[model samples]
Target: MAYKFALCLTLPHNTTKMKKKTIILLILAAIVGLAQFIRPDNIKKYENGVKTEDLAGVPKEVNEILRNSCFNCHSSSSELAWYDKITPVSFLVASHIQEGTEVLNFKDWMSMSIAKQKAVLYYSINKIRSGEMPLSSYILAHPAAKINKNQMQVLEAYLLSISARGKTDSVKLKALERDHKWVKPALNGIAYMPDYRNWKAISTTDRFDNGTMRIIFANEVAVAAIKAKNINPWPDGSVLAKAAWTQEIALDGSVSTGQFVQVEYMIKDSKKYAKTEGWGWARWKGDDLRPYGKTINFTTECISCHRPVRENDNVFTIPLNLK
Candidate 1:
């Protein structure tokens, strides 16, 4: 009788435990079923139908590597894998795709502006060189996507070639801008950039304490006038380009001037700039290449700096030949 009573007690406990597990399983089933209904597959964004063929003449080798490794997330040609069809998996895949394309989408390559395209290409090359791309997470499941040494070399060479082409195109664009008088939106400044590289070098200044280096170039007419020291009232169109750079300790332990810092252009415009002085000032910083300061304040700092030398046409550099 006691044994029977013990069995009766144990039976209810076991039954209760079983019932609890069943309830938990039912709740999990309901949660999973509900989650499936909230699928993100249909929600489309930035679905520009840009295609691989759009990059028409891209080399087969580079195209192969890009399609196999990059297209999964970085292109519109994303062919979702089996797991990518699932709820959260789909969400993650979509998010990665969105992010990858924003950075460098091969499909949209041709449509991007030349500058933007070159920037993306350079960025991509740097990332590849650093071995930061073909993310480990991606390569884990897709061994074929891993880039080999030879493949990297091929990509680097191809990208450099493309970058060289971009440089040529940029020069042509600048020439067009110079001749056609391109008027950029005023950032309190003017955008009258000339081919200052072709101008004659007048002088160079280096200040090591401040890590600053400057090169002054002058137009042909200005140089000739300075040689004769007859440039008292400087004629119009006599522009001076001062390119600045930053001094840095290079990898070889040598101190050298690094990337461009700024370019200050002093353009002689007697009638246009007679208000403050006889010079129209404009500046471009770093890789921006856009002129800065369109207002009179541009002259406030400039004029004040040149005030002490007002006796010399309100200019600073008298040139060696002028002496």
Candidate 2:
């Protein structure tokens, strides 16, 4: 009799436990369903509000490749797939579009300077040659966008003129490196960034720094400009206007020491931007590389987050002149 009574009591407890689990599962299901409804696939293009000119003096083959393969993300007109409308995936697609548009927008290609126009073409050719563009993830989805070695070479050859012009900037880069003095400024002062669209943080490149000061490139653009014919305006904010420099270090066996000039800039246009749009710098000491020292009392909304064209070196305008 005692055993049967114990069984009855235990049965109710098990029943209650199962009921709670069912309720929890149902709630989770409902939450997921609601999330799908809330964040449906809705992608939109955000233009820098500039216009583009006609394709002039560009190879027809190169133009077709860009429009069919790259334009979806790199241009204003994104070819949204049906999968883009699904949950979770929708957010991913939207983010890609946002980031891609932020870096390079084909819709607004005419606003850039002639020097920049040439730079864009060369950058694209390099990106293709290095196989760093059309992103592997993108190519996985769209196999047709993939190019052969011959196609890549063809595009590169077609861009030889633009690349030739980009070579002129190498002198400036070399001059800046040699002439620029190393000034270690405190990181708590005002920082200035000219345009929000063309800014990024100082990155620590292990490849360039020999594991020391960590080579940093700043004031970089995010994407290569188009060189296709009739593609003008090329975007203005793609060019960064601010102070950019690298740091040097002295080291011991176990510890690293010394300081190099970080970065400093004053707001050139105070009326157009807010105090948040000020000057800032970063210091790299050993492994603890963060924005430190004296800084101007300004916010870092505009420049600190601009997408980089290179790995992390914000300044992508500087073409690697192999020509």
Candidate 3:
């Protein structure tokens, strides 16, 4: 009788524990089911269709590779997988597509100048070679988007074939030497600072599209801000200079600087430059140092190109850390 009583009491306690577990599982299931109804706004509805005519000059093979690897996020014709439509995952997918298009939109391809198109291709090639594109998270779900080595070689060859080599102009060179001391100010009133050549080089870049190499130099104010890790706004009076030169390729495949191309400057003064994103933008092209714009509105192009990096104060170069 005593053993029977103890057994009966334990059965009720075990039943209560099982009932609590069942209730907890049902609540979790309900939460997951309800979450499925909370979907993000479809980003595709607002996008324009990408037509073949928009990519008129692109070779078919190159276009195929770009469409397969890049268009899903960079263009309007994004192909979302079934799993990508899930609530949380769909939100992430939409965010990625939005950011990608903001950085480089294929829909704007035909609208860009031929020179700008080439520059975009060069920049894209660099990102692909570095494996910084197609995003690892994205590639995980869509393996077909990963660019293969053969595709990479094809893109590289096309870029090289289109790049024009710099030609020598002795008369122009002589004139440039003679007029070295009389460079003019930009249309927006930013003066040419020839002494930027003496500033410390903070970074270097190559423009394969134009067959040019560039060196970025920072003024003392910029350098100090960089060292102090306070360069987001780049303190007032900070100046940066980017000088470019044509690249001369030797028979042995060696490359060296050839002719001067242009030099651009960015001077930070938040209050003074409030209308131009807190920086005075200027560019002087060629060895003769001719100002690059007919009107002050030319700064509009610079502002647009740097808009994607607004979080970084519209600055692109990340300065090297000082020892």
The deviation in Å at residue 86 for candidate 1 is: 10
Q: Candidate 3 lDDT, tens digit per residue, 63-180? A: 9899888886887667677777776787888888888888998877765545566789999999999999979999998998899989999999888766645544434334434434
Candidate with best TM-score? 1
Global lDDT of each candidate:
0.71, 0.50, 0.83
Please give the range of 10 consecutive residues that has the lowest summed lDDT in model 1: 177-186
> Which prediction has more favorable TM-score, 2 or 3?
3
lDDT of 3 at 300: 99
Highest lDDT against the true fold, candidate: 3
Candidate 1, pairs of clashing residues: 188-293, 188-294, 189-294
Q: How well does candidate 3 match the true structure in TM-score terms? A: 0.45
Cα-based lDDT at residue 235, candidate 3 = 99
Error of 3 at 29 (Å): 99
Q: Residue 230 of model 3: what lDDT?
A: 90
